[model samples]
Target chain A: MQTKETIVCRCEDITLEEIKSLIDQGYRTIDEIKRVIRAGMGPCQGRTCRMLIAQELAKYYGIPVGEVLMPTFRPTVRPVKLGTFAGGE
Target chain B: MPKVKETEILIVGGGPAGLSAASAAANLGASVLVLERDEKPGGQLIKQTHKFFGSKKQYAGDRGYQIGDLLIEQCGNNPKVEVWTNTTALGIYEDGVVTAEGRAKHLKINPKKIIVATGASEKMITFPNNDLPGIYGAGAVQTLMNVHGIVPGRRVLMIGAGNIGLIVSYQLMQAGVEIAAIIEAAPTIGGYLVHASKIRRAGVPILTSHTITEAYGNESVEGAIICKLDEGWQPVSGSEQDLKVDVICLAVGLSPLTELCFQADCQMKYVSELSGHVPVRNEHLETTRPGLYVAGDVSGVEEASSAMVEGRLAGISAACSLGYGEDIAPKLQAEALAELSELRAGPAGQKTLRGIMNLMDKGGAVC
Candidate 1:
């Protein structure tokens, strides 16, 4: 049996083991995982890890992927620096 | 506060569509300006090494990057067309005002017309352990190997049989990476048979009706488990097959990035055939809101060939509306539409036709 040490969320460096452990602890939805471990809340802004986490939760619950609640996406869609707004950058 | 800029025609995105629009509009004697978010102007066109497939007018034999450069060169040569690299159009505000962040200065542009040509983003697939570091979207991998000139991994497991997956698989192989397998949930390969054959001749097995069940590794992607799917697309429990791989490339599809269009108050509708919600535009590529237009993937998830055609249509329409090139506008738009219709007449284009028809039937094409 392979232990989960592979990284799922690279930005925050969250591991597969950590995610599975969180799931085992009964965090069912993606929102719950984001709440517990911050997998999707990162600099890349979940563009990389969002679908992965959503599908993982869907698979773990043996549900359709479309059924998984996606985290709400906000705009500033492309990264805009706060400093750019303040004339600092 | 940044200085406000004014132009006759303002185009967002500097890829094939935007550049084509700039060239067309500027050639018609309208002052055109293009704002691209990237440091360079090619968009994803820079990351493509393969020659595109279309008629000679669309550069059927030339490489994608070459065509991109050609578009830029011609557009750049137009005295009336100005391109600003590293410029991101933040939004198209009400009253036809636009705000953008430029490399050297922030810009508030008031243009006579606006065209949004922002392209699409890669779609992802779900599988157990998909979050592993080695997993990547086809676009990301293309950007890595094709754009940055770095091989992403030693071995790749390609998911989906679409053009991006097929093309990227070949591009990776050309770059000295081994492909373990290409698994598609569809019974038949999704892309052109020609592309599928090229990979097949290279000794890569095309596994149809199969899907990745999970990817497993401790530190990175070391292996993947694929399984055959039943009629309902559920994994057939006993058909699990594992393969050793370092990277998993998902080339499922692309969805149009219509955020700017939405911000501009363009009506959007969910059309699965077009790869998701796209801005509703009339025959001339004009959206419901006057003076605002859309082209490229932002209008609908179509090929670069069609994007260019649509761009020319919008460019000509906008230029004519502003009292430039009125005599030739109708002929030019008709030719663009004809070329687009022919390009979409292939076996691959039937679906696009259906998608467009579906949208039109649902009033998504109202303008």
Candidate 2:
């Protein structure tokens, strides 16, 4: 049982119960989970929360931690302020 | 107008490694520029206050932050070097092109040589209530106290007995924070005995072969459950104990932040001894890509001393690649590699040495 108010993503304040509910509802992978509920898309860019979700999925599938497929590695790994990109071409 | 920035050498990150790279390349007459994401250019060095080990050239036995200042000044003093703070190097692309984002604008950069000195990130261990707000990575805790002067909490439970964990535990004590205990999964302490002894004398108990089973808290960390583990790393049933702690600091480990290297098409190897997936580089720290180099924790997780040496090797090699430093590259590389071997000597560095050997596909000749 997960609490709806239990926060997972601190920047966006997404909750564990929300993530578990998503996983239980067939959003098993991180990609599907991210599309449904934005957990790792915050300022941290999943620095704090990404591996937790992957470990959870690995446990659920009875697979090793290395077997879990991670999300795509994108640039701008560190969060840039919105104004940083709002400039001329 | 957005003008394209040009330089002979582009070094990403300005920590001990990148700064060393800059100083080396600049000394060799290569136009050098460093892109640092932090507001200040010390990287993790700003958070360190303890004396370091290794050679005198690296300023061994001085406080870490002071060394950071020394390196910063050295880089700043170089006529050919320029450092941009608060600038994030996004990634490397074809034809020596890289993108960077500053405070209010994005810029395109083209350089003849590139060094990836992006360093490493703290790794978190899994446990119940691990998502609690009061739980912090070791680096985060250090930055809070050393940089922002904010004490994390009154009492803390440190998980992991590696160098970072041991050093931070002592630093927390210096900051007037109480350490509840240190729980490590390994049978023996993972860091040096010197560091462990300092904290042990401070009346902190380091429980070996133990793991944090759960953390108890409502909204913030209020307590933790630690259990002794068998050789298999499975927790023993009757060994669990709940301890009172306001903060849980995970010093479990660090992993090299090699995603940029991956994006640049550098070959990588998963070596746990090196702290996760690291790029496969040659003796000169040149990765699979020509004119592309790596230094410090981005190449592998190690201390700043060796990182600085590796940075020098990479810098000299990059300089040579661009038709500079021809006279000094050979001697500089040999001396740096020698310094690295001396630092990595003894039982402590055996695993890392092995990992480096495996990655290089050679024996200890590189040392």
Candidate 3:
């Protein structure tokens, strides 16, 4: 059987129909959609796509929209050169 | 007289956003240079193996590292783009100048336009024994397992049920580590139900409304004491439960690395909604300081896709400011704005958009 193709957020690589199907299956949380679709798992760490998914999921669940759990930041928030991180002096 | 190296655009990050910006600018025949801090070009992408979601333009359905490889290839194919690995951009100066020191040489460049696609880092909470040897950040664990062929610990106690916590828990399991349980301070799981369910079906109990009050063990993490919390995030009495574990992983949140922007005297505002104090920039991603632009998480914590869009806009804006071209500015801006609008269309983005709008309405720096 051919898998249905759906693009969620072009930015984060999430699918549109995949998200809709997941919501139909009762996966209501934005976090749920992220795992299934890898919505906010990109390098931007879902900075852009996460909110879009959260709103979509909220609407699908028929509940008041809520905040999606954002990923935590690490040190050297900017991509630091390994040489810089290792103290290239 | 003096060696004058010239590039139309300087991108100061090799992550997804930075690379995308470079490709976008190079596609338009602009000279672009990408400086990455890591030994390898791909930032965070090297460790991510899962497929992406979104449009074909975003390269949806591909792994992050694969996308990075494609960007590297694209950069190679285009002579206009130059990538300098193992290089760190120390500061952004006035007039679009970027100061840097790499493994072999110290250099200064005054690119007409620059894009600061510096990404955000992982955030960890500090408890009494947080500094223990075995205690690691969730990202650290990922790097250890995904990047390097090593395991952080045999048994782990993951704190925070958000995506990082849940996904890392599953990864740890995949790496053959025993997960005691996933503990979260919030009343609900912060990550996706699919991730939680993946772990749940694998028999990992997710203890929501609970937190790691303290990590036990002197030398390393021998155990951790978890407890239920009230709605206000305070621990409840007599609900403490101790579990034997060897490692404690923190996946709390992230804060923008605006030290460079702050040092350069860019106007900043502290909005809890956007993670922390970020540079106050207009729609073009230009900071209050002329010629200084911010993108990726440094602007406001968002995903790589938005970062890429923001980075492209910032690059084009900087290039146009430098007389590269102005005809494509409106077209590029509209496309980027559209992509940005789509990314922020969901509920999770509401508060962040509100934060930005509030900052924009404030009309200047918060502090």
Candidate 4:
């Protein structure tokens, strides 16, 4: 696999190589990766990429996929316009 | 302040589980409000064209969509149940106010009890060029071909031999599309033999212990590279096979849609047997937080049959908590529990049974 070109986070356009390099640097967990590369900080809010990242981390750490703690899910589950929340039309 | 609508019971999602819950709660004389994100209330059932298999109570031998229609009709006829379509639940606040956006307006709902039957989302697998066009989740393919009259593509490579994969392959054939092959990473097929037999009889090859290494395409899916896996699940070198296909459909399983459950601070546990992380709830389907209940895939991924039973159990339990149907709720709850156990008695139900037991053992409320 061409890790350099293969995309992992579609929303942020992060690559597999970027994620792997971060893991090697000891930046583990989806939340840490998200803070550094904005992987899960997009509009979809990690709906598509979090699990993939979890699987990658699990493979690297030799742990069960479920043992990888999932990132915290905040409110406004789906994206809503700022105006909608501020009582604007 | 946004318009605040009050109801005795609030059910999130209007699929088979939510609709059954709405009917069950309404039958117990509770005013129920159901919120559905889509334009319609059937959820996944709207795209299923094949006949369902189950006991008669679950509408066995009836087509999937027809069963959906019946459940919709039941909810529609009940005066105490109100369904809001195209409404998405945005958040569950600490103060017990649920916010939703729909129909060009944002509103807040205050209900005495809440039942989350939000269902699950399709799981995705990573490979080269997986983000290219012409790649779709199995549900999206069904929506394209079954819901709309448009065919997805001329030929397709299907990943995962689960029931969704096999059934969608048959549905694609019925829509005049060619299936290149159906592949499963596991050595044995995951779906029912009946569904597998139908596609097998149609001359489509079912390959087990195989997986796609990469999708070949510049812009859209033009082909795929598949290879066999060894005992360790590593792809064998020099065993690669290339196939010509336009569409790649992934039916590789699903994870529960539990964003709201997490937001509400319900106790959650990761049970891989149930697919992914799920809320820890009691036999009555009530989560750790009182008045917040879960049914269907929101609690744990299971069949539509068990989802309906869980919905009914959650519905009656929630209504009974709100001081409705006290005389008959116990009987109905017991019946629902019995039906659920019976549905989980087959060999196929072993994984789900184990998942449920794990949840129970890990401090799920006994009720």
Q: Which one wins on lDDT?
A: 4
Cα lDDT tens digits for candidate 2, B1-367: 4778999999999999999999998898899999998889988888899998877898888988998999999998998999999888886776668988876688789998899999988886655677777899988999999989999999999999999999999999999999999989999999999999999998999999999877777778889889999999898999889999999999988878887887787766766688777788888888887788999998889999888998988999899888887987899889998988988897877888999877777322232
Backbone-clash count (model 3)? 42
Best candidate, DockQ: 4
Itemize residue pairs with steric clashes in candidate 4: none
**Clash pairs (backbone) in predicted model 1:** A6-B218
User: What lDDT score is found at residue B207 in candidate 2?
Assistant: 96
Compute the lDDT of residue B282 as modeled in candidate 3: 89
Task: Note the Cα lDDT for every prediction shown.
Answer: 0.83, 0.84, 0.73, 0.90
Candidate 1: tens digits of C-alpha lDDT, residues B1-367:
7667999999999988898898999989999989998988977888889988989988899888898899989987899999999888877777888888887455789999998888887876545676778999988999999888999999999998988899999999999999999999988898998999999999999999999878988888899999999888888989999899999998988877776776777766767788876777788888878889988888778788888888888899999999999999999989999999999999889989998887777755654
Ten-residue region with minimum lDDT total, candidate 1 chain B: B358-367
B-chain TM-scores per prediction: 0.97, 0.97, 0.93, 0.98
Q: How do the candidates rank by lDDT, highest first?
A: 4, 2, 1, 3
Where model 1 places Cα greater than 4 Å from the true spot, the runs are: A1-75
Error of 4 at B81 (Å): 0.7
Off by over 4 Å in 3: A1-89, B1-5, B94-96, B363-367
lDDT of 3 by residue, A1-89 (tens): 13322333544645565677788898867667777777766654455455456557667656544333333332222334455434444
Worst 10 residues of 4 chain B by lDDT: B358-367
Question: Interface RMSD for every prediction, one decimal?
Answer: 4.6, 4.4, 16.2, 2.7
